[model samples]
Target: MKVGILDSTLREGEQTPGVVFTMEQRVEIAKALSDLGVSMIEAGHPAVSPDIYEGIKRIVKLKREGEITSEILGHSRAVKRDVEIASELEVDRIAIFYGVSDIHLKAKTKTTREEALNVIADVVGYAKAHGVKVRFTAEDATRTDLNYLVRVAKTARDAGADRISIADTVGILYPTKTRELFSYLVREIPGVEFDIHAHNDLGMAVANALAAVEGGATIIHATVNGLGERVGIVALQSVAAALKYHFNVEVVRLDKLVSVSSLVEKYSGIPTPPNFPITGDYAFVHKAGVHVAGILSDPRTYEFMPPETFGRSRDYVIDKYTGKHALKDRFERLGVKLDDREMEQVLAKIKSSQGTRYFRDVDLLEIAEEVTGKVLKPRPPERIEAVVSVKCGSNVYTTSVTRRLSVIPGVKEVMEISGDYDIVVRVEARDSTELNNVIESIRSVKGVESTLTSLVLKKM
Candidate 1:
């Protein structure tokens, strides 16, 4: 069976406290998910406000315009008013949900089991009658009594709901229990499509979703970056990669995963942890000496999934524990070829540093040059001095040009002079090549009409 993804980044994900997506950001995310081949995009609930209603309408228009291929769904409660608002938005599907557990019904909705079922039947029937698909959700399904959950499922099914969603609303379900619950539901509610919406409070959201799939669930609800209430739901990147790599189940475009995650993280204002799976900053980085050596030899030795699979490249971080192989690879990538002796010297320096800190590319190059007694690039001369006069089109450009010239690599100082020159600059270089390059850099600055350079033959 082909498992489909129901991305709720704009719906349940926006429910994350302190998280809000502008209307444009919502549309952009929907388009990106559609392009990524997601089966459905749950735009926010229309009943929330006119802004959300307009957002859903815009998504529907995108689908109609053929800009997006995925079906757009709007969320709603098991209330007639909610369903009516969703119908007005004209989404491809309407997700009608109601709290079925005893606690939620008592403390939240304050409705009896019978009354809740009646409400589900009415809303499901209303949504179906409006010529739109209906997905019924049993909010807090894992905590609800099995008998009551079955009755609620049967009520929605009989009332013409197209699909049923079992939400681990509080993330209380684990792998084994999730499998068992879905297995029972799939057996009892035969012929009805089932979706799983797992939360991540227990950090098992992805695992539980996979378990549900093994037990016959065909749809998995997830949010990009796992953005949602109190922790969040299953992360789209994690679950999609798990489904593809672990289960050999292809759901969405794997390569587009990282881009989607980045887009959501930027617009959502919720930064993803560096250790977050798949899309995290450190997810594909290797720092340990042994691991780096293994990865350098063959990436598959230490990595289960290649970074290229998600549009990311493996990063070999250099620190105190870096191996010779990793260092050699890094030097080659930087266009600095190091011989065996030179390589060992650089490695020794890194290991003996006062504090264990990673070296930047420039720092590493400098270290390599120092150890090899060779310069990768020409260095500025130590004692030579020169005066540069810069002419600018306007006084407005003089200060800016002086500021620019003051920061060039070989520039020692800059001053605005009242002579024929607009600005007088003093520079020093180790060799003619370095001085010439610095002069060229100064000439290249915008608003500089011309420059005259005079070298000091002898600096007594």
Candidate 2:
């Protein structure tokens, strides 16, 4: 079965508390999503703020110019004014939402069901009248009575809604219930495509989304990192991966998933957790000895899906759990042939070390050299350059700090600078580990309050 994806990273994703994207960031994200191949991009609510309206306008302009290929969507309430505002922006589709559940209708909308149905008809018809496609969302549809929800959906369809979105707003639906609900909707409301917006409050957004697909939902609403209000919604990457791997449906450019995810992560300022699925740092990293051994023999033994499928690579870490096989493999990869005794001694030394639990490549190399009593060829150096801004205490003399910083091993140039920071230092290091050491040494200077580092990716 085929399913479409409607990415709301700029709409629902911005609703994440304390999250806001600059106009440039919004455009960049939209372009990335377009390249990643989502069916539609819900830019933002045009009526909410002038900035949001302007962002949507710029994104719509990009779509018009063929810079982005995905259809742009606008969000609105089931009010004429909302639809009117959305209409002015020229979005390909406008998604209008209203509470359908009794709890929401009575407490939030303060209207009877009959009156609410009238509002739906009026706004949907208004949007359709403007020659714009319409999508009607029954907010809290999961908690609403099934018959009433169907009535609301049918009312929208009759009023010319192009699609109906069944939102599990509070994440109350499990897999079985989600399947049953969408199954009924597909049966009751024919001729209109259905979309599923599953929240992650109960931590089943991806599972429920897959269930909705099984129940015949043709579209799934998602965000770049599952970012949305409260606990957010289903993740775009997880949904795409599940669809492709489990259901044999391909809907997106699978190789671009991690790049887009990283783009959103950078703009949102919310770091993706190391253990997050699909695009996380440790998702493809193996640490345990048995797991690493199995992975070395055949990745399929430990990994159900290969990292290369999503433009990622498998990684292994050496720790106290390191086994002889893993150690030998590491040594061989490094072009160092280790005899059995030398390998055992190195492993024993690594396990007994009390400094840190995980050993870096440099640390392992040093240990191997010490244990083998042989001068191993030095690995090729990696050049990394960075600019660090240092903040100094008010009472401290800046010159003394700069002088001390200038004497640090990797410090190439140190200059006292005005503005937010007292000193700007440029340094080059062999690798990230060495770069971190340089930064730590800079922080240890007496007058330094704090330091911010920006790596130089390319030089003009």
Candidate 3:
């Protein structure tokens, strides 16, 4: 199936409570989204603020300069001035929205349904007259009377809208209903393509988006980390992954999802929940003994998709539930050589350590040495230990900085502290080459300004 991704991290994502993206951050995010191969980027609502308008201008300039390939979209309302402002930004496409549901009309727009249709026609036509592609969004479309909603969409289409967005503004649709709605719209409207703008108020945005596609939507609107108003819209990563894995339709660059999600998580100041579907930190992690054993035996037993498919690695945790298979795997991977007796001793100590969820590589090394009464030197890839202290820009979020650092493969620990350096990260690697690569990755993070590293000479 052919599908397009319209990521709104800069628009609806900004509407997330207390979330704000600086102009530079917005540009950086746009670049990342372009690299992820999204079909369109809803840059921002130009009518919302001057800063947003300027940001959209810069993004459009990037496209003109050939720095980005995604089509840029500017959001607007039914007002002509709103469309005028967006058109002035020179965005490749303009998205004009107006409430079509009677509830929304009475509560928000205070306009009759007929008047609403007239406004949409006027504004959508105005944008098209200026030679810009237009998408007319019927806000709260799911709750709108089906016949009236169809009329609204047809009005916009007649006025030159190239597409129509069926927005589940309050996220009240079930997957079946969503599919039915899109099917009806696609059957009713012949020329214009359909886009699904699903909100996550009911926690079904991703499901609904996929259903919409199954019905006939060619475009799925999403935001990184599900950032938006209320519970947010469908997550860009989740929807993209679903499209590729569930339907075998690759809409965006799958491998770039993790890095792009991290970038948005950092800038949006909204942490991706550990349980988030595709790009969460624990998405591919296994900790339970039974699960770890199954994963070790055959990843297909516990994993539907390999972590490496998304440029991520599978991880395991060592805690009370740690089984022998998990322990042995960790030990061997860390290059820790121990006899059966010593391994049992190590497991006992770990299990009895109150409730420590994780042990740093250095801590494991110390424990191995203590149990064996000899210096346990790990082999090649696990031989090096380095402490890296990172200083971030004054304006950066320290928690986000720490979260970013903690996810690096070699990084074992990350702490935010009050000092010259905002964060300290401990990393384990094989040699200087791996160490340098890890450090470079750290330096490349958005807020990291500088880093100082020191190699470990001895654990004691």
Best by TM-score: 2
lDDT of 1 by residue, 1-460 (tens): 6699999999999999867777888899999999998999999998898888888889899999999999889999888889889898789999999999999999999999999999889889988999999999999999999999999999999998879999999999999999999999999997599999999999999999999999999999999989899999999998999998877977899899877886786666565767889988788989989999998889999888989988889987888899899999888777778889889999999999987567766668879888988887543224567999988876444775666566565777899989688988898787788889888877866558899999988755
* Model 3 vs. true fold: TM: 0.85
By TM-score rank, best first, the candidates go 2, 3, 1
Query: Comparing 1 and 2 by TM-score, which wins?
Result: 2
Q: What would the TM-scores of all predictions be?
A: 0.81, 0.86, 0.85
Give the better candidate number (2 or 3) by TM-score.
2
**CA lDDT, every prediction?**
0.87, 0.90, 0.89
Query: For residue 309, what is the lDDT in candidate 2?
Result: 91
Q: Predictions ranked by lDDT, top down?
A: 2, 3, 1
Best model number under lDDT: 2
Alpha-carbon RMSD, each predicted model: 10.7, 7.2, 3.6
- Candidate 3: regions farther than 4 A off: 369-374, 379-460
Model 2 C-alpha lDDT per residue in residues 364-383, reported as the tens digit of each score: 78898898777787653547
Between 1 and 3, whose lDDT is larger?
3
Residue 412 error for model 1, in Å?
A: 26
Can you give the lDDT of residue 8 in candidate 3? 95
